[model samples]
Target: MTGNGADRKTALVISAHAADFVWRCGGAIALHQARGYEVTVACLSFGERGESAKLWKQEGMTLEAVKSARRNEAEAAAKALDVHDIRFFDLGDYPLEMDRDAKFRLVDLIRAVQPNFMFSHSRFDPYNTDHMYATQIALETRMIAQAWGHNPSEKVLGAPQLYLFEPHQTEQMGWRPDVFLDISEVWDKKRAAIECMQGQEHLWTYYTNVAENRGNHFRRNSGGMAGGRPARYAEGFETVFPRTVDELG
Candidate 1:
């Protein structure tokens, strides 16, 4: 948000599973990194319990093995996206439950990062409760981080816009995207990052198609059929907080 560009800006992404961020907003992460934002991705769980079907299909895959593989894949994906500050909550998935202490830990991270904006799952997802649960924690932690009485010494959080990335089934989840990001320049980076999630290799091409479709949406919204910027890949987001502007651009 700084115009001078001397100070470093930050953005936080809260992913329910290890591979969620890669599939949902890898382009956004890469694009923001190019824009000089220090993007931090926090995976709430390894998704071993529910999401790692490929790994589980193996003859004798243990929970520890699944967790290790997921962590490694997530680290590699983050690296591909130029994200250096990735954290694994290791909270366990299927039903990601965060206790009071866990919530406080997340709040501490929010205070430390003080991101300009945040990204998480849609508000509601019937197929995946873990995804919705992560967003709930995101909302709670953001509120706690902004509380004056939560911790007197720690820095309080500012009003950072929480953007819900597109869900797997947007229509069913009631996720309406109001903002479209032109990530055509970073599509290669995103595709590379998507490849890092080896456990979910099937999703690689699926998300590529998603980016292509979102690009069409971007062109349509930004002045379609006339003179819209030619974007080949894009990402969509639904803002949770009201954006304040000097004037309507």
Candidate 2:
């Protein structure tokens, strides 16, 4: 708030579950926060139903216990990146369908935050129905935010940039990321940030591998990996609403 105005340019990361952003766009979030960007993390659910039993067995983790544990973990991770706003929607764990009211709430949040950039999982993720539903929520929220007369209040809230974070889809999902943000400098912070997910049992490693692979892909595109490299370690994103056709075309 002191260094840079939080209201100016904000980033909102909306994930289906507690650890989705940690496993995918942790580095990107850290990088944005380091650059004085206001960051908000919104978890649709605490993933209570999916948390590793082998890890939380010692805590006698129930649904409430798991949700509390995940909240603390998410707070720690967001704090590591200097994120100010961390919210959880608590819309159940596995099934994240958008009942009309839920979509309106999401639209209201988009209108209130007015994030310049948004990060969410792809709609094509087949492994998790929640991810696809979350993506749907993001898309519908974007539409609602921009719909004039329809949402009288949101008419003032202009359309914000939206980016779909990479899903855990290597072969079947067919996700092609069109935007990549260099996060090499924040990689360590990203690793440190994700370690806070105690319920995850070192889930950072999977993302680290993804980052490394993306880094190599970055190198291949830029002709180098480090030292004045064009975005070595990064997170890849696809635009849900394509505003610019110059490059995309």
Candidate 3:
């Protein structure tokens, strides 16, 4: 929306934890990168205390050690997906509180990326308050990015779609995804990225099944038993904001 040509096609993923993007929207990231779009992932935390239970079971594991391990895995996963950039805020999880400065920092990233669309966690996650908190931060930063008075020297952000990606235990989270992306083309890349989350090996299979089930939904929604795209793997997302179009389907 900011410019023309391939360089203008950009996307931002605001993840609550190091591996959230990998599990939720890894295929979208890889597929977008494959289609000449630069996708940047921003992780607020390394999920050291809350999401790194396996690593904590180690004999002599420390907080820094767990954080380092998660960071390494995220970097490798980003590499596998050919991500344009991956940033770690090191904001420590469990509560995942953000001060005014932290929110401003994210606003800066939003303006810099100037993404055509953005991805973040679900709005409500009782199981993981950190996930919902990340979504709140995503919405706040996006609004700040669009304000002219926030940083008059830089270009204000345009209206980019903020997509709320699906969450674990989604049934209880009230996350209804209206968008289904076919990631069959990049399923291998997604799987490779999923495998990189060595600390959270338990979730790897669960997410794989999620992709497969979402693929079925994609096919059915597109037109099942008639003329549907054969998507073997997919990801679902719920849109946070509405769009303004000249025409509607």
- Tens digits of per-residue lDDT, candidate 3, 1-249, equal 333245469999999999999999999999999998999999999999999999999999999999999999999999999999999998889989899998999998888889999999999999999999999999989998989899899988888898999999999999999999999999999999999999999998999999999999999999899988889899999997887777888
CA error at residue 162 for candidate 1, angstroms: 0.1
How far is 160's C-alpha from truth in model 3 (Å)? 0.5
lDDT by residue (1-249, candidate 1, tens digit) is 312135968999999999999999899999999998999999999999898889999999999999999999999999999994999999998789999999999998888888988999999999999999999999999999989999988878888889999999888999999999999999989999998888988888889999999999999888899888889999999989887888997
Model 1 has an lDDT value of: 0.91
Query: After superposition, which runs of candidate 2 have C-alpha atoms over 4 Å from their true positions?
Result: 1-7, 55-59, 224-232, 245-249
On TM-score, the stronger of 2 and 3 is 3
Span of 10 residues, lowest total lDDT, candidate 3? 1-10
User: Each prediction's TM-score against the native?
Assistant: 0.97, 0.87, 0.97
Candidate 3 pairs with clashing backbones: none
171-231, model 2: which lDDT tens digit per residue? Answer: 6676788767778888878887778887776556777878888886776666553443655
lDDT of 1 at 199: 92
C-alpha lDDT (0 to 100) for residue 40 of candidate 2: 86
Query: Could you say which candidate leads in lDDT?
Result: 3
